[model samples]
Target: MAVTSEPVLAIDVGGTRMKGSVVDAAGRELHGCTRPTPRADGPDAVVEAVVAFAADLTARAGGVAAAGIVVPGIVDEDSGTAVLSANLGWRDLPMRSVLEARLGVPLAFGQDVRAGGLAEVRLGAARGARDALFVPIGTGIGAAVVLDGRPVSGSGFAGEIGHLVVDAGGAACGCGLRGCLETVASAPAVARRYAARTGRATPVPEIAAAAGRGDDPAAVAVWAEAVDALAGVFATCATLLGPEIVVVGGGLAESGALLLDPLRAALDGRLSFQRRPRVVRAALGDRAGALGAGLMARERLQAGVGSAR
Candidate 1:
């Protein structure tokens, strides 16, 4: 009798959507689905959606051995608590316990971007690098730090690099701070700044394209400000952590050389004693979070590490 292995359930919950998957041991996704996160309906609604989504994936997998879930915001992985999610409007929620109780299985829980960093190191762009940064810049900005081959959680407060102040007395941030890196460099910030400057609405890609051709002075200026802000942040990271590489993902990274080229140059110009990191694009795209969740579940299952009720 050939004993087949049971798959594991993986869910990556974001402010806007939840990605769920049934994954086999080899990191292959056997099945997958996405659902709106329903955060606007309130946090509890999002929780219910996740529970239902996980149950559906488990059922489709014919019973999963375990599950892993990752979410945005401040996640205390050791304590299995979601400390805070500004976007999701929740704080100090016992996420792992809640899910484990409903799912009736051992579960692994973590921060979404940290999970993405792990997936990158294990299976994506940052492979073979002991120290790296996986930064996903989209609706918001966040960083995942890998040090000595391990992702740093910092008791759920470690990776808020977006809140790092780059421009003193500059634009306000949703985090209630002024001059945050996110204020100047996030995807929306780029578009918003351009729109404010020109009174014309444009997407980031179009802006980057215009900037690339040097045709639109506004695009060039906006793109330069974003790039400069990012360089400032990355320069700080270089001096503080000296990561060997940086994997840039999310919406802004789609700009490719228009972003990375100037970023590398700016970062290099700032470095004298610090080892400059090789900045590159993330390989996994939007699926990185889900794949990371799967990797976490599979690794936990293999190591017999889980949150059991």
Candidate 2:
């Protein structure tokens, strides 16, 4: 088979599923697929699934120039290692080496949230911004901090803003912290808190809708708490990072103004002498990670070409 021209495979591994795509040089996805992450099957199985997914995309694309994979956790990008991922049950996994050996292709490995942030800055909501924050609040909350038009990995542990303590005595977090921002502001947390209060298991969007209608006190209260916690976190980030914009993504971001308006107000209220960032919705949606991975793969391909010359 003839090798595909300037096409690369991109994979974004999440706690629930893995998204794969074949993207061309222009950053257009030619093909894409999603598969269960098989977290219950163990971390090793997850790694195998990711490799297999890449191989499948390569075959479908008639072969790719390179591949990029991003996973959650403390990713040592310099060493191409998935240092730790509580959700995926991995630790010290040399994912890049393993995938390179398995697929016989160059691989670019990175942290999922950071990859999404890169996409946001380079191609989406935070484009052209010198400093920005990309926070995606889904089943979990994570952030990507971009400074001076570059994403800061901080040696692989920089952007775990979700674990930042917001409420000292609040809910317990999976990371063994109490009252972490994620426990209150994540999409899952919003649904869980509303369910606990109203004894009705509703999705985050439904809860936001109820709050918008002003018909359910429980929904309104839960949403308010999430907004307050998120605002506090953003205020702290703004004070420290001085990001010009905060691009909110993930499942909760779908709520649009229901989440952003109050969040902006609360964040503004908390700031005394800090740069007030424009809180906006993510433009790339769920595809940010995959596109970012594609960008990484293209970079790897270009590096290889340059080195060969």
Candidate 3:
């Protein structure tokens, strides 16, 4: 059921870059473009970059049918508004109309993580999966829950697993909460917290290396806490959604066996009384968000065509 009409312009707005792609119905990018996020310059500049990026791709692609934009924030998908992005510094942005006007194409707006989950379910790791979870462990620990082939964006705000309060009295989160999973288990937390305790400023990969050696007390303590917190969240998500698989992604998942081995063990122990979903790494890696947005755009166009017919 691949709709071979005009391609779509896919945009994924991240803290670091605004990635753009002109993609076909089958989730293949025809032309790729990216720009650095103007964090100091603010939201308007970012929007401008997205528009320029889309225009470049559309020109290269000859034309585009629609645009799909995935943003990092509490997105009000119903209204196509970015509710707030702490990292991107946007609030209640009317993103859909802005892009539609700029790019001159129908726009489908979505949360970045949710869109990634959509990509996974449709064409990536979770294809044919009735239930699955996509968790990206990077600067933060965010998740997207997919149930029965559709992501459960509960009241437009589902799968915010990072803010899940794992420790009531732990470190304060950016959302102003204390002892959040993000505060404990995110990649930055893994590095910075380990450094704070040991007074050694090593990155997460180095910390994992030390942990693998099994002698660094700082590595043991921080990695143990991170793994425990992450496992706790996974167990809770599994207990709730009972997914067939939980696909893990983001910068931290690159740790490979260092992450998977202890994570599996901890998750298995935590889910002793519950159904344990197989926790695996995401297949698409860094491109999941962009690819996911492209998939959603194709679906939206298909649905529109179906309804019209």
Candidate 4:
């Protein structure tokens, strides 16, 4: 094994695609690419695709010093295993070990949302906050909680706020739970709910636009439900965690003031003595996960762990 200053290979695995980058020690991306995840081909194929992606990235980088890979699901960071991912259809997969063997590089493996949160803390919006929450509400809702400047994993099952019961009688969630926050606040949920109400399938962005324009009463109602649900969740999180800031990311966050203004107002109305966390949009956009993966790889390299086997 040799210690080198070579850039790291970072990969962020999503349900739909896998993003790869060769990132320098400074966390700057040197090269990048994206590939479709072979999820339709089954879990085994997804794993193979990840390995192939890493190997290709390593080669493109002329040899990476280390690698970081983040995926969605119940990821046991300590064990370097992806326990389960309903979207990817995998279970108890030892992703770190497999990638290490296949790529012949030291690897850092973690959950995607957690990685994004870490990235936000280390290099983005939550940089100075010791207590913070990063919630990315995309096709689904997931969160990353940082306490005392470090992410709280709860042994990989910690941040599933999306499944929290915000509306006990609202709607059923994919997690087999009724009235989950995700049912009301997630991007897909907003689109679905709007379609269900209007008998017209409108994308979330369109609904948000309509709400912004104040033209469609149905759109306004749908958006309000999402904002209200989100505010409720934020209030609960504030009561429990006392986060100084809540960084909102993902597709929904793109609505900017359209989402944040109403959310902030609603959240303020709900809080009594709880510290009102400043809710803001994520600074990293869709690249947070990939950048976080890079940061994880660099940290592992600096720690001298995950040495090449």
Model 2, 1-309: lDDT tens digits are: 223357989999989989999998778899999999999999889888887888788999998888889988899877788889888999988888888889888888898888999999999998899899999998888899999987888778898999999899899888898999999988888888998998898978989998988899999999999999999999989989999999999999999999898899899899998888999999999999989888888777777633210
* Candidate 1 structure quality by residue, lDDT tens digits, 1-309: 112256889999988888888888777889988988898889888888889999888888889988999999999988889899877877999888889899987788899999999889889999999999999999888899999887899889998989999999999888898999998999999999999999999989999999999999999999999999999899899999999999999999988999999999989998899988999999999888888888777766666654321
Backbone clashes counted, model 1? 0
Off by over 4 Å in 3: 1-3, 305-309
In model 2, the runs with Cα more than 4 Å from the true position are 1-5, 305-309
Q: What does the lDDT read for residue 54 in candidate 4?
A: 86
Model 3: per-residue lDDT, tens digit, 1-309?
444467888889899888888887656778887888887788788777777777888888988887788988788766777888877888988877777677777778888998888888777788788899999999887788888887776645788899999999888888899999989888988988998998888989989988888999889889989999899989888887788898888988988888888999999998766778888888888788888888777766877732210
Tens digit of per-residue lDDT, candidate 4, span 1-309: 245467998899999999999987667789999999998999999988999888888888889998899999899887888898877897998878887788887899899999999999989998899999999999889999999987788878988999999889878788888999999999988988999989998888889989989999999999999999999999999999999999999999999999999999999999999988999999999899998888888777877774311
RMSD of each candidate? 2.1, 2.8, 2.2, 2.1
- Give, for candidate 4, the lowest lDDT window spanning 10 residues: 300-309
lDDT of predicted model 1:
0.88
